[model samples]
Target chain A: MTDTLLEIDNLSVDYETGRGDLQALRDITFNVNKGEIVGIVGESGCGKSTLISSILRLTAPNTRFREGEIRFKGQDLLQVSERHMRDLRGADISIVFQDPMQTHNPVLTIGQQMLDIQHRSKQSKADKRAHATKMLGAVGIPDPEARLKQYPHEFSGGMRQRIAIAMALMSEPDLLIADEPTTALDATLEVQIIERLQELQREFHCAILFISHHLGVIAELCDRVVVMYAGAVVESGDVREIFHDPKHPYTRRLIECDPGHLKERARVLPTIPGEVPDLANLPGGCIFRDRCDQALARCATEVPPLDQLKEGHHAACWLNHEEATS
Target chain B: MSLLNVVDLNTSYGAVNVLAGVSFSVEPGETYALVGESGSGKTTVIRAIAGLAPAQEGSVTFEGQEIRGAPEKVMRPLRKDMAMMFQDPVGSLSPRLTIRSLITEPYRIQGMKDRDLDTEAKRLLEMVNLPTHFADRYPYQLSGGQARRVGVARALALEPKLILADEPTAGLDVSVQGELLNLLNDLRERLGLAMVIITHNLSVVRHVADRMGILYLGRLVEEGTTETIFNEPRHPYTRCLLSANPEPDPDARLDRIALKGEPPSLLMRPSGCEFRERCPFSKEICTQTPEWEVNGGHGLRCLAPLS
Candidate 1:
């Protein structure tokens, strides 16, 4: 019996904009195993947020999608009723966003806001408060009881983010989706958050879908990684394998573009020239061909499929396909 | 002599002090990066130097001219030789103005009405790698990178010798950030422009800055060349900061020397050493302020033995 916790197959979504229909996500297929951490890495406008929204069924009003199946624990989430979905959200699956202050209500006290999340629970008020305190302490928040009375404005940015994380795990969710949770944090605070998250993930035994544009954070936290480019999953594999030996051109460029990877400062850091393609008016075939240095003549005419490069490693690129067949 | 010198700088907002006894200098053609976490007073240090934020008890000299608390008449003509690039590129640019006028507005302020504004605007646009067609477009029409480049072009409109760029690479993607840093570096080399760049990103400092100062809770705790700072950081906070920066490679062995807690609040700062509460090497003497220990021009404010 496979222990797949969440399975996303051929997920495609488009947003209706004034320019036209923007193909935000294209034929994305991946799965997260039970208690495993998966990271999605991409630049801006690469459909990372759209993919998360699709999983939560929280896409924008003008979003159009029909060719995908999002299954959580062998149950199709798309087919679930709205009421059932609402129950499953905080209890089964929870998410933490980039900005915790924006996610929280400024007018309410921290304690009141956390208790509000537990309205569906059958536990008494006292038990819920104790549970909130415990979860807050679990995230290394000091003096959780005293902090409950304080409003969001009273806490620092890092502390507010910790509160957000604690609230996300209040219901003991089986899966936590953190979208750039540490992006807004300072370097020292980022390390603190990552350490606390790793500790809590083990204590709760939950799978995590970590989404970020920072390759460094993803490399340190995620067990497996998925590289996104122009609304497609260009590469997916174990973190170690993908970092040591990235097969796709786009994934390689993304890694090379990181300043930390450089041993010494160069006159000019190598960059992946050209902006991400316009989704509403994408060119024929592969999306990355325009910026890819090793793009072959056939790359502009044929769409590459996600082919297996090694055990548990996959990349969608014509170069990888040709190398595999040769 | 240094192109810009800041000494014993202290700044405050009402009751709370933002910068305390901070000091640094920028040589001609050199990039001095002031690095710290948010609220650590990195921005305040540059703002104090630029005269936007008043220095409570210190001196800021540009080309050996005191301007920290100088009157507007004395500071106005001096401002023409200094330019500031803001953090938020979109918010900094005027939404109603065209790119052409935005670049030339500085010249208009300098009372150079005889200059051909359109040609100069196009030249500035091309210098920042923006297309000539963008000169006619409004601020809302450009991408984030384009907007930032436009910001850079506008900053260069005055052709200032010294540029104070506040988080120039903030809110930019990695690839775009690399390109922007390269442009800044190239301009510095080609034009010998001295820059005082305030940013929290250590990677950017490592790539572009010749020298750096690490700030913690409004104090300049460490100052040294970039190579020495990254290779052998003396202060405990500097060591922890470098270690905490997540390296991109998965296999890079990072020493897990994380600080115990978040920075202490400014309202109730620690009595003596501002970082004493969070420093791993805090001891009995840490209850009192430690003198700046200097050796070979590299300095640190901690009493701990160098590792």
Candidate 2:
């Protein structure tokens, strides 16, 4: 899409092990439009984490990207220098990690963390407290003035998450990536935080890359979704279309698997026969061939291209798309 | 007869009262939900009933016998009648012990005689839909769903009349969560067990709980049937609780009620109506404790109850 905020082409990541080179992600391609929430969803160990890490260059020395282009806001992130990337990390692009308990410094006060974010954006330490309070209040932290003095341990799980979100937004990045930010919270608070985050996203006019294992969450926050499996993009489409009439077998299984999503499917839940295939040593041809109920002989020997079905929607399956053309 | 009856339950931590003037009853095959946010003291009431923590006031009657603060030995027999599942599966199940040994720990502690611990453990595992060979593996060897199954097996080992599950499906993926919830519902029906599920999930209560109770700070603000709570929440706190939860489906848009400010500490709780400070519809009587009102069997703790 010409209006795309991000266009990842042939992205691949590798993890070096004693046994051999572990292929964590293989030739993944996807895009997120401006102001659209695009979800990257997969079960744990399906390389969801690796994909996020690669985007931020947070991968350890043991991991390496073989080939890909990460074009964000018309700039190549992979080719950017450390100094340039550091400036972009919080100011131009930001991330909210899964666990605030670990992401937040336990001993430091919420004020200190907020100040740190402001400091990164070239604000004075003395003037950061007020800015921090304003940011915290914006995130819906009640009595942000008094709360700034309290340490992370003193805050409840939900409150800590709010503070963490405040930190992510302090710099007001254009692209905000949240990976399972509500996983550790109670359901009551989980819903509140997500709602608040959605409001904030709209108010800030920023694109969100929401990552989670639950398709239910993607159904909630994402405008578009990119289904990942065994280090490949299985399907990509508008959230409503993909959810209502999923074509790919993996996408169909995922929609049928979620109890909450079954409101639409409205039948007996169909679980995928086996667990996510091991990414390190993948078989030739389509990675989903072994598990697909409709797998043909050609699917086992030749890799299927991510073919277009309609405007801004694609699926990598050997299905007839001419009939589905809109 | 009601399997469990708690009346005017007033529990405390040191001098701080956490549960005040609470009353509820669980029928032989009913599921009761204790729903609330953090610091709402839902867990405290369960802990008090389990005797992990003591209730400073009120009575807990099991099988029509009241035991306010009995000695551990006097309460020993009742322990067999109740079992609790913790939120953290790893912490609840011993990392050092195999799944087989974990399930039998309750029986071992009570010093039961002529019990085939291994065989019973394996059967319990199967009951929870765990693989038979998983009995040999420790907690670390299992996946999140497997560990949850082990926890369920351990909780079911003694065939307790009542089960207190604290956030049973927290930290699990969606598919696994559905399986675990369905499994629990199936078990409850087959065993005719009474379950008091403590969670903040409104959707969870909708599917599993027959009745609902809403707690705020340290008080039971509302109590009624699931349909009553969802359809006509009388208390402002309960309404806010429901409205706060965003529907996972994007097609549905919910105008959430923003509950600003932290919950007042129990050490020095607000004068009256713990939720008054953040309540959207607080009235003059909100400053004073509202009298309980019953309409169509639904009781509410709000000055201006929803009609």
Candidate 3:
């Protein structure tokens, strides 16, 4: 049986904005299984970042968790004390952000920052340095020993991202949250980073909670995919199923609209009409109904529950309902 | 004759050489894409063409007029016919300026006092499919896609014959990117405008660009029709780039060619072929710079080209 590494159940978050209560995440539910790479794909304002922040317990000051439980290793992270959360952050979970340039401390040497991450470890200083060097080398950095002494500025964008990945995986955390880690890099560099992450994941045997807006990267890297739209989980399934046979209209449109997926060059690429509804003043019915082409009349008044369409595949849409389809 | 011709263009910033003998041309209604990594000088090529970055050497002829080193007086009038859409959607626009002023500012800058700015602003917004009410909104108030629409509207304000767009779909979501691409494509067709698009996105290049040039160390490694280049790439760098693009299809074959290391710094470019350091097919001859060779409308600058 597959082991679940992390689980989020009925998670809802709201930001107390001047305009109104901005519902950032609404009943978000998903889990990262042991050693499995699961990607959370969504556009901006889809609450992907908010979800990441919530998991790290680094939400904004005006944030309120409406209702949810973030369970990790049989412990509810939401119920954990700040001291306990700090201990679990690096030791059990690690994150690699989008911009590596901003991620690193300019004044600190790479070696120093990497060593600082191991503060929880009782390992000797020499052992820590050795581990850091080895981790750097594992991520394809040349001369890791000498490189550790250098500053982040000395490295190129690709190299800095590699260093960032190395630092994140140094602790060998059970779950690695990569928030658009390759988005800032070029296509060639993106490919290199993806391959490196795949290799590192294999070596460390860590589950990856990969988050990105790029459908191509998610398709290439993740085994399963969770498609988010306007602060809600629209669909979740195997990567093949999600891309090949998407059930939700949003997921289908998102996949079809991806330029990378187009087989032939067309002058007018298909586009999903309408903007994402305002989070502060959401529509009465389904969040995505306004934009969904095949939206039904029932979608105007009632919210669709996430239903099991197939084994391990779930989609939240009125069209997926038995009676609605009939 | 081509609408815009850039021959042997060379641009340097202080001590560092960015664009080294780059050359290309765009037809009156064609779209030409410049593809490269971050430091490959794709943006710099367009910047030099637009006279924003003065090129130290080479010629840029627009509509039979030499404009490489043209003074502002000479270039100002030409700006009406050739507009630029910057990379950043919101950041490119002034935060304080209303969307109406932002898009219509071009007309004011050109000193065209005859036109009513309000009507023109509404017309521009309508063209970009943005609502008329959005004219009063600030750059910060608009979404990424909306901000991009404003950028397009601003570029189209003067009824330019040619447009230079940099990374048009860089920051948008998949669906939004498609919408922007569709809008751009529709505008290009409707106005019969030529375009020079600079971006690292291969998919965007494939969808929008009629012809494309692959830049390595500020030099064009390959130049040809998008169809020909995508189907039969001669340069090893081109092949590597295409292979590196992750296909959205999960079942697609993953025969990725991982380059050895990052691109060499511009301050100290590798001798001979600049791409040789990372190239998998580097030979003894690669130590000497390969001459740019063209065959059957396809051009390449590599001694050890893929057969």
**Which candidate number has the best DockQ?**
3
Give the runs in model 3 whose Cα sits over 4 Å from its true position: A323-326
Give the DockQ (2 decimals) of all models. Answer: 0.77, 0.31, 0.82
Q: For every candidate structure, what is the RMSD over all alpha carbons to the true structure, in angstroms?
A: 1.6, 3.3, 1.7
Ranked candidates, highest DockQ first = 3, 1, 2
Off by over 4 Å in 1: none
Position B271, candidate 2: lDDT: 76
Q: Provide backbone clash counts, one per model.
A: 0, 0, 0
- Model 2: residues with Cα > 4 Å off, grouped in runs: A1-3, A16-23, A64-66, A73-87, A142-146, A213-217, A249-253, A256-274, A280-304, A319-326, B75-77
Which docking band does candidate 2 fall into? acceptable
List clashing residue pairs in candidate 3. none
DockQ of 2: 0.31
Error of 3 at B149 (Å): 1.1
lDDT of 1 by residue, A5-122 (tens): 9999998888999999999999999999989999999998888999898888897899998589899998888889999898888899999999876989999999999999999889
What's the lDDT of the predicted structure labeled candidate 3?
Answer: 0.92
Q: Can you write out model 2's per-residue Cα lDDT over B1-307, one digit (the tens) per residue? A: 7888998889876777888877888998789999988778888888777778778888888888776687888778787878899888888887899888898888887788679987888789889877788878889988877788888888888888889888887767656676788788778878888899987766667778889898887778899998888888888888888876645465767667767666777788887777788887878887887766677878888887767
The 0-to-1 C-alpha lDDT of every candidate, in the order given, reads 0.88, 0.80, 0.92
Give the per-residue lDDT of model 1 (tens digit) for B243-277: 88898888888877878777887778888777888
